[model samples]
Target: MQLEIISRLPSTKSTKPPILCIHGAYNRAWCWDKYFLPYFAQAGYPAYALSLRGHGNSAGANRLYWASLADYVHDVAQVSQNLAQPPILIGHSMGGMIVQKYWEAHHSHPAAILMASVPPCGLWSPSIYLACQDPELLWQLNLIQFFGLRFVTPSLLKKALFSEPTTAEIIQNYLAQLQPESQRVILDMLWLDLPTLHSQPTSPLLVLGAANDKVFPQFLVNWTAKIYDTQAHIFPNMAHTMMLEPAWQKVADYILSWLQERKL
Candidate 1:
């Protein structure tokens, strides 16, 4: 339940609520601290990133393999409970699925941002596509997460996460920071723990995707947006890890603009 916060309160104490960023599988709050947290904070809105129960510096690292998707939801809910008010939830990949589940259980947020997220349907489509097109990449991912080792080569990492302009040094640093995720969460994504599509929340949703994202392509992002009756803004020449990409500032700027337009 630990949080990494970047606070920049205005002299008069602005009325804007903070943003809570939730990281995806194999990642932690540090993912947001790298760019989004500071960028948003500099824009006059406090931002926070949460380390789920077993990820990063949070507790329950030893119990990761046995932790269920519900456990992840509880982690998010607990963090929400501690906030002054329900913060705008910005979730990435598996974290997006967690946000969806959180909404189903308790729809209490100003808005939600789903970035390169897993679709509500499930992980089956993406898994099958990767297995067919690049089985080796999928195999390496499994090796890294399930076996608690890093098996990803630089080429594969670039193919799956980054775009052409990304430097090798950035890729190396990010790869080094990658951690193992819960096996139960992986299994749940494939089948058991998909989000509830029936009771979808009507909160303002901003769905953003990258054109070059090999994991969740534009089509998948559009599908999620369509379900919520919105259009997706696809960033060109970017990949799955858009937030950490070289042009991350553009993404942050767009989100800031959207928040202003919606008055959230």
Candidate 2:
């Protein structure tokens, strides 16, 4: 699978791997930073954003049928494996799942960052369970979805995706980047035990969460960090899209500090 990679480099290259960002499912690479690319580049680290197989700037139109959870691992693999030093591998939502799965199966460790990620094996989620109780209801649900696409939720639900930067413009911008698919196969992809994955990490891992995000929620984020025996922090006035929020610089600063403290 071809990855669509865009780079914004710092004025100089050092012997370290630049920060590499991975966007969540149904989103393109540019979803990373309205301010992130230039800010990090200016801060002296080469910055990169990847469009996994069918999303964003990458080439498949199967936006409906052509990608998998592992395909995203391949995307991250391509970008981070070649770093001068291991690049800080950051992922959001489904992208977070990808990073976790990759680390579980491979030797790459670029100090992962996961944001608003879904719990693996949530195909049995209560919401999914309830939706499947009635045969006719299930059929209705399937129609609204493409591959695995869910029906658009109300704004109240959207509010949960972010706490800060809830402006109409920001919402519209994200909506424009949304991709839909009826591909449920990816949802069944089993992830390794989080505790086990965390145990094997060779570098410091940061689990950044939005104080107000409900999609992945604070408790889950904290749980993920705690299991890893590392650190977790909340972004004040931030959302699931921490990398794009008004206080994105604050998140980046945290990332820099985490790396500095651990020397990753």
Candidate 3:
């Protein structure tokens, strides 16, 4: 149960609620450390990102295949509970669904941000969409679940994650860090662990998506927002991994502005 939580604190203390970022499938907490943690910390919010039990430097990699969505939710609950104050939860992709599950279970966070998150209905729609729209990419992604990084290539990675062509170094670096996601968690997200609308929280919510995200298309993002009675802001020319994109600052700035508007 020793999850890895990476944190960055601002030089000047502020009253803003700490921000906790959750990464998507095939990703770890380090995904946030490169840009988000520092950006938010510099903005005076204590930013933290935690690797789920089997990801990053966290323990339980040996048991990754059996890790369930509930287990991932437990990890998030543990970290957020240990924070000084209730955190503003920001989750991307699968992590976003995790945030939804967390809120449905605890309903204690100050606010929640869902970026390129899966819709409450589940990943079935996207799976179908990808199956038709880009079968190779979908096939590669499935192969990755069992084969890990060996099945990934710069071209496929770019197609799956980025709208614009990324540098070779960046692609290699990400490839090196990418890990196989849990099949059990994937199955849960595909259907088993969907959030309950009846238990939805009343706290503020923000839904964001990339205009060019192939994984969770803009329509799904809109659907996710609509389900929560909110609107989604889709960034043009961005892909699934918005935080690591070239214009990542735009996404960061947008989130910062939203947080400021709420006076969080």
Candidate 4:
């Protein structure tokens, strides 16, 4: 597991606790580096992004196709344990699911944030909803899930993750860095890897969603928040990749405000 540390000063001198950002499927720590890592670091919080095994420059890239969700959780757990103090875990999409699993296994973080997270019930609800709402889009995602990178099309990618305000250059850069995710992990999301919700999480949790997110839309995000007894905030005019979306700073500001409100 490779931890991409974004620190301006020594951790001991920071006013806020470190933040550990976990990227979603087909993404790595590099995605966080683009906006989140720097934003949080500049906000006076030390930040670190973890490249789960087989993703980004992390070890085992060659065997990623066969890796499971549990394996990804292990990567997160390792990074969490190595941190100087429990970090505020922030995860998006599949990474959010991974954070849920980590919290279930070890409730060490002071707080957690789920951005366009996979629902606690698992991928079935979102999958079924997308299938019903947009069969054509679902079909394209299915193609990518099973067949990998070649199945992806620029138009589909843009519609799936971005909105009208996002420029072509940003979308192109994101696509160029996007890689094929593990089929095994996708399968786990669909079936084998549902997060346990029986035990209420001890840490304060913030659940966020984008109004235009194709994958985990508002309905699913709200459902996720309901299970945790928290509110799901839906940002208008944004899509799945909120961190990289044109209005990314808005999301960052909200998170910072939330942290301050909670006194974390």
Runs off by more than 4 Å, candidate 1: 1-12
- 2 against 4, candidate with superior TM-score: 4
- Select the stronger candidate by lDDT from 1 and 3: 3
* Model 3 root-mean-square deviation: 1.0
Candidate achieving the largest TM-score? 3
TM-score of predicted structure 3: 0.97
lDDT of 1 at 29: 79
Instruction: Please report how far candidate 3 places residue 31 from its true position, in Å.
Output: 0.8
lDDT of 1 at 187: 81
Superposed model 2: Cα runs more than 4 Å off? 63-66, 120-157, 189-199
Can you tell me which runs of candidate 3 are displaced by over 4 Å? none
**What is the Å distance of residue 59 in model 1 from its true position?**
0.4
Q: Candidate 3 lDDT, tens digit per residue, 216-240?
A: 9999999999889999999998999
After TM-score superposition, the amount by which residue 11's alpha carbon in candidate 4 deviates from its true location, in angstroms, is 10
Model 4: how far is 253 from its true place, Å?
Answer: 0.5
Clashing pairs in 4: none
Best of the candidates, lDDT? 3
Give the whole-model CA lDDT for all candidates, comma-separated.
Answer: 0.83, 0.66, 0.91, 0.86
lDDT tens digits, residue span 41-140, model 1: 7777767788887777788888988888789888888887887778899999998888888888877789999999998877888878778878988777
